[model samples]
Target chain A: MASVLRPAAISRQTCSLVSNRTALLQQASRTRFSETLRTSYLLRESRCLSTTQRKSPSRIPSNDPVAAPFHTSARRQILPPGPQVIEGGVNDPAPVPPTSPTHGSYHWVFERAMSAALIPLTIAPFAAGSLNPVMDALLCAGIIIHSHIGFQSSIIDYVPDKRLPKTRAFFWWALRAATVVVAIGFFEFETNDVGLTEAIKKIWTAKRKEDSYVEPVLRGVA
Target chain B: MISQRFTQISARRVFAQRSISLTSTRFSAPALITACKPLTQSRPAATQTVPEDEAYSILKAQRAVRPVSPHLTIYQTQIPWTLSALNRITGIILSGGFYVFGAAYLVSPLLGWHLESSALAASFAELPTAVKLLLKFGVALPFTYHSWNGMRHLVWDSGRQFSNKMVVRSGQVVIGLTVVSSGALAVYGL
Candidate 1:
């Protein structure tokens, strides 16, 4: 309004409710201020305030030559909680993520190495023409680990933590616990009974109806 | 008097740029430089500045009506993507199987379940030959395909074999390998 600053007692209160960025944005939106007062100066000034240190309102000069600010009873507007939209705009920068070989490229390398290792592992027993129980258990565990990683990726992609926080967390921990239990099962089968590979071999060669010593058929075979 | 007043504004204009970024510093420095500036900007009464939150509210209203990003169902299927989809599906099947069997095996010791190779084998052997081959083929299809396609993925991850032709060719090769190996296993194992 043309009456931008009236001759009134302006309160100098430290802005405690909203961020300085909000205040800065509010100030920037009024481009007409520069048009009426110092042409084009405030327009350029507001833009440069987007830097990190601008959040501190302590730097605003308490005194100046201009007309004084006054207290108004009108309520200031605030952003509402949207369902999918996240907090902060492009100006608000994310925290710098910590980087190391273990969290970065090495994880990728480890995945590839594990995948490459599996190829040799798959052929090793067949090339030697023997079913070593230890070798069989190791391979099964390797596959489980590989599967666990893949499943985790799927969970990350589909059950995003942003959209479904609780469900994502549940699926993650459940998968981890399930993986550990399955590993245990695989090991037990290997130690106390004929392991996974041998079970496949036996089934492939199995020939008769009356061969089971147990009376009931097993359910839930993976 | 008018010329003198214009001269002061011209002088202030010369140094306005240096103080542009400094809101607090700009006010405090008038003593040092005598740069005359108004305490408040004088805006016209007609146009108004919408608060940041109000602008966001307008944006939020627009977004609520905006269509979401299209899901995979809207996609046109092709060979490469189909093969990629199948690879993932097979991976899920294989991993899911391992989890189930692993749990069963773990509890087998406690339950007195004869999940030993011979017992499971004998149980499976009771099925008719056709059913047996069919079962093997069904399981084998996913297993063999997933395994071979996994190698293809590993190769692709290395940033090689990314051409459209190579992807299609490799996919076909994987399918062929799966059929031949799975068929041989079913027949020979039988």
Candidate 2:
């Protein structure tokens, strides 16, 4: 009876130890699997988060946000393509602010005034007006400067004007001639010994006197 | 027996009162409990994917602004240009003015007629007021235009408003200021 009882107890203890060992192994495997699953889930979640953040669209689309706020709303809207839609194909070379309309009108007014001014400019010399010579000189100098500037501007804008070598040559020659004549006239007037009108009258009188001599000589010969 | 029965009745009464109070509390808070559900349901859908070249193609399809050609044909004979031409003409005129002035000055001393002085005086007296006024104004116009336009040029010098709009506006302002000042001087004989 003692031997049979001892064997029974030993078998029972071995069975219990084996069962405990199997249970311990199973729990260790489950913990490792769960840890691996958790790590994979974390990696997937991080990747998804990064993708969303990077793919988000910007609210304002324009490079020049300050100048063109309307472009943002325009970019958001959808419409059918057409000729008008084709306008948006290229990023408009940064839009140049429109030139002021007032400038054109101002130019027009200036042109009119300048036209009207000619009448006075032309009349001034003949008016025999008691103008201060200094003032007249100043005025002439100013006009010369203005013209010089205008001519230069024209040269820049109209390169073709220069390309026509003959036209350019003629213009320069005419300008030089005008300058010389004016200078000579100015000096002559400054030193003239008689009034312009008196000088003319004297010439007339001398011609008459010469005529009178011719007639007398002819009569004497006859 | 009497004590035991009293304890049982008291416990039953307490249980019934607790049930009535719980029911009333739940009814009072029903609206508050249901509020958050609709907010979660109303979230917007996620954005769809797009092709890489879509933006580039859209930009390419847009129209380009053509450059404007300068119009030199019309009013080619206007003030700015006319003034340029007059610069040449004025040289001739000044020579004549000097001759006239000199003749009158020099001949007046020898000739009793003093043709130069009288001519100078008579010329002034003979001119129409309108013409005289116009000449007076003309004298000032060039200076005024130059000064005002010079300021405009200076503005350009500073590298501000170098745009087409500003250039045009400034050109106009220069002209307007010139006209107003010139007109005022002509009327006032300043």
Candidate 3:
């Protein structure tokens, strides 16, 4: 009985060892097959690259086919030599100096005068009694002009006023019309209609009185 | 023979279970493995041209369903409501101040006409002292509130009073200053 059991156990152990060896052999074969495939692929790539390099000697100067076309095109498009005489000739028209300095001085003087005028003008509305129609008209004109200019400046600065031609023209026309209307109203208010009407009535009365006196003198002479 | 067959079946079952366990262990590698596969599979094939209609539909869906971040509308009103209300009130007072200044400047010059043609002094003398005091107080309240609140805004400009406690304290200080200054000015007729 012991002899039979011992042979069976040894046979089982040998079978397990044979299976382990088969698995290791299969893994080694797979690794070798993959390595051979990689080597063949690399060789094919290198051969194709070398054949193309040999065909185009002028284009592939550095033996790098990827950079060949780029370098050739860049050399072909290089700029030609420039003009021999760089400086201007006497025949060329003289360059005019800019008028910015004159403009700057004018702007400075104008700004100073306007700023001085504005300080007194801001308080003028209050100082000029409300009953004085002439002063009121002047104050109204100043306020309207100030408001219109301020509005136009702000619109120009912040809005897309310049981008749309129609809107820009509309704003320009609106500002001009507003100025005309305000000016007409201000002049109408400033005129002395009451005094003028009274003077006309007095002239008519004096002419009637003279006519009555002349007719009486004629009757007395007859 | 039956016992031998049973032992062979048990050995095969044990090996199958071991292989299944090894396959299960692969899932524990990382979350990126599962995440990347779906993304790659969902991409459109490079060779296929998508219909323009379908492209437009997809873009429209993307535009409509895109997430918007939370804003002030999402937060419930609490202490911030008080601050916003105070700001609005101050803005209204400032606008009213412009009218007040305009009327005063325009009418102050007409005071002579108004006093002579109208019974202005007699009307003022008829009013109760308490009403006179109230009118005086009304004039001082707006100026004091505006001045105190302007100072608080200056503090905010300097970037302090950011914390919730500081906000509450500053609000209290604003109220105290407004009441104290306006009341004192009104009483003293300053």
Candidate 4:
């Protein structure tokens, strides 16, 4: 009886050992295959990969939801860490620095200030009726500069250098020329005509002494 | 034997009642759930367009690559951007005021009005001192601001005072000068 029991126990132990070895061998081969699959996925680096090609059912049990390929695409469609160029043969543009050199851009501050100043410079004379050459000259300079800046800003906002590079250049030069002509005309008015303030004042109280008339036309007749 | 059987049947009835009461309390929640289950099951399942997912991804990618302007909503507004925007706004206001007023002045001659007349002058003089001062100040405020800001801009054009600290400092100085100068002009003009 002891001899029979010993042989039976020995056979049971051997069978268990053989089964354990086979399981381990199977697990090793699965892990090796999964590793190879992962490397292939990395190499392909394709934007779109089919579920069967991408997923490897390594750790998940066969009955698990993730072990199947049905929802693999949904799981894979996650936002990447940063911008990814999925499409082939596309290169990102190099980063460009800002055009303005200043930090807070004092020019912008000054521009605002100038615009604010024009209100007082203009109205003080209108309210007071005190027209001096000094005031006129100042007004002349302020109006010219202020208007130029305003027009320039409008041009810049509308005509970006990126879209119409040459047009932008042309407009800039044209604007400068226009500004020069306007400035000259204003200066001429300042020097020659009843100055800007006086002219405005004259216009304000201007009275029409006569009815509007056109010169009588004469034509040659037989 | 009949009495014994009757006693057993009574005990059995009490035990059954107690079990029914306890189990009813315990399963009441599950019963409510079971009641709701049929209603949910009656509804049709949602269908998905699986094939269009590829097209959706491609469209999404295209959107990601598309060039878009930096809209005002997304960016953090800074002093430079704000101030520049204000400058443009003020410029428009000032220019518009000039054009409108100038046009009115030009057309006044045709309308039979004396702009330089003594009556108009006398009327202006008749205005209260406070009103006069207020008007002068109103005029001076814009003048002072615009002039000082323009100076700050000129300094910038020269490529000096480009640092952050300098910009802030200069901004404060410009405001200070505008206030002081405008106040002085307002008083003197009044």
Candidate 5:
């Protein structure tokens, strides 16, 4: 409504509604003004009041239901973790600088694409009837990276920068170190042991170690 | 005529006094006082004049009385949040297992432990049938559930079936699939 109303657009005949209470008080105080000037001023005030007709911003419909209730200050003051509205006036934007979509728009796409890609990589080894070393490596890398990203996101959400900056930074570094160590461990397992998929397969099928080499089709590699 | 005119004036004064008496008797004292109150209104809450800077501290003190919004306790046990929590737990289990096993494997050369494929197979073979089945089921359940729900999350990322009904239904489907599939894998030991 502030943006809607234009003070400069005030007509010569109509009331200058932008004129503050002091302006009205000044007019009321002046003894030199005739009855005609007083009548015009009173008429202008009445015209302005009649035009508005008790309209307010709250009366305007808003699409955002959650925010609509807190649009007013008194109700907003009751919100949790202390008053969010206390930092600024009701119409003020958040303290953070405006972010550009170009910086992070592809992040969602990349994450989704990577997550989707892992699904195929999971079954491709089994589908091929024999686990290729390259495919196995791919699966391990994908799963590890996916898990790392997932954990990172979880930490970011649970440990916000605003409340616990130091804690968040510590966790961030700890997660990075853990991820690196985990990658090295995965590499060792892949290179030396029967690899991730094959090892899981062997463990799952292990009975009495006598038939430990049996495949999905009951073919013995022994 | 003069006596009649004086009587009229006395009668008017008497009527005014009677009305005041009636008002006092009919209404409560608060109502009478409200009625007598002038056009200029007094504030509802008692206030003291304070410095502008000091006023902020009063506001801060008042703000402290309010509880945080959307508290976990305030929410009823709902499917979407419950499933999301399960997903987090399962993810933790899976990833944590991966990291632990990976680290152990990396350090195995230094520890001189036999973490070889044959060694693992033989050790796993030693476990009782029930234990083996339990372990397989435990591992498989989380894997299948996480896999299925992760797919559901992928679908959500694509911005389809976003309604509460779809999410609840999908979560149920994920749970059902996990139970059936993991149980089958456990029994078959495949």
Candidate 6:
């Protein structure tokens, strides 16, 4: 009887010991799986850093000093794809914008310079109340250029490429065409007529009958 | 009878002890609980599966596809932006006003009011000197401000006066020039 009991007791002790060992092994594996995940994350971060560093130098060309800083590639960094998704959820990464330089700093600078030049161009005419051909030509040129710049800026603000790309392009070209036509008409008027400012002065100073508009009324009255 | 009841209670106690020993696995220790807490807490609850209704999903998708531009109110008002906006406003008003007056002058003859009519010139000539000066100032003020501000923007185009100090300085200078020049024109009728 004693011998039989001893074998049963030993078997029970071994069973408990086996379970404890298996539990310990599971714990160790769980820790190792976590460590591998952490190491992979570190590796991914370093890879991203190296890629951005490598791409920047190539993207910013040496010739384009004005566009170097503002280029889309230089301004933004692409993030890595996220971990796997379990659910049928919307996990699409954000859209990556295409890289291109639309305009240079010099373009904006020229717009501003034209604006400054208009001050003297407009003021002298108003103050003198006379029409000199040189001043009139300068005035016409300045007005056309200034309006073109102003309209372009408005177009850029209200009609961004991201929202309405086609409309933006269409309006931009339309503005250019309109500016050209208007400039041509203005030059014709400035040269053939007494000129813009002098014409305005004439309207102010003319007598009721002598005024051009009054000639038709006088003819009708008779 | 008492001895029999004692034995029954002892037997039940032994059964409870066996069940307790079976349930208490080594993995369920206090150390394991602490280790698991950090893992659970590190990830946010939103990372878990969140069931959404079809309507909600559609709305979210729409918002994602057509994201709105930031509103004008979001930005802090600065001198250059404010002045530039004013310049555009004044420019539109001045030009529109000119076209309207010119059109009126052209059509006045058909209505029996002639552009060169002595009555109109007489009415204008009879206005009090102060009222005329005020009227002249009103017209001159917008033109002067717009022109001066345009000059400031032009200076900005030259890549100078871009810094905060220079921008502010130029803005002050423009305002000063507008006030001085317009006041001189109004008072002296230059």
Tens-place lDDT digits, model 4, residues A1-222: 011123332323233333364464455445545654554343233223554544443533344221112111222323322232343223856656677735346767666677566667766885789568878878878877877777787988877675467878998998787666566656655665567777645433333232112212222231
DockQ of 1: 0.23
Backbone clash pairs for candidate 2 read: A89-B59, A89-B61, A89-B62, A90-B59, A90-B62, A99-B165, A100-B165, A186-B95, A189-B99, B104-B116
Which lDDT values do the candidates have, in the order given?
0.67, 0.43, 0.45, 0.54, 0.67, 0.55
Cα error of candidate 2 at position B87, Å: 14
Q: Cα deviation in Å at residue A157, candidate 3?
A: 19
| DockQ metric for all predictions | 0.23, 0.03, 0.02, 0.03, 0.17, 0.05
- For model 2, residues A92-205, the per-residue Cα lDDT tens digits are 675565787565667545544443443454345436532344444444443443443344344444434423556556666665554445444434443453433334223222
Q: Residue B30: error of model 2 in Å?
A: 82
- Residue clash pairs of candidate 5: none
Clashes of 4: 18
Q: What is the lDDT of residue B75 in candidate 2?
A: 46
Model 3 pairs in collision? none
How well is each residue in B132-176 modelled by candidate 5, as lDDT tens digits? 999899988888888899999988988998998999999889989
Q: Tell me the deviation in Å of residue B129 in model 5.
A: 1.5
Per-residue accuracy of model 4 over B1-190 as CA lDDT, tens digit each: 9988756544433333343244434444435334332211111112356565565565445444332334565568765656556556655666555544444444455787554334454455556667766766776676566666666766786699978888777877877887898778656633
Ranking by DockQ: 1, 5, 6, 4, 2, 3
Best by DockQ: 1
Q: For model 3, how does the per-residue alpha-carbon lDDT over B2-61 read when each residue is reduced to its tens digit?
A: 988756644543333333244434443233233222211111111357796765555444
> What TM-score number comes out for model 5?
0.61
- Model 6: residues >4 Å from true position, as ranges? A1-106, A126-128, A200-222, B1-22, B25-80, B91-139, B156-166, B183-190
Better of 4 and 6 by lDDT: 6
lDDT of 4 at A57: 35
TM-score against native, each model: 0.61, 0.29, 0.27, 0.39, 0.61, 0.47
- Total residue pair clashes for candidate 3: 0
Top candidate by TM-score: 5
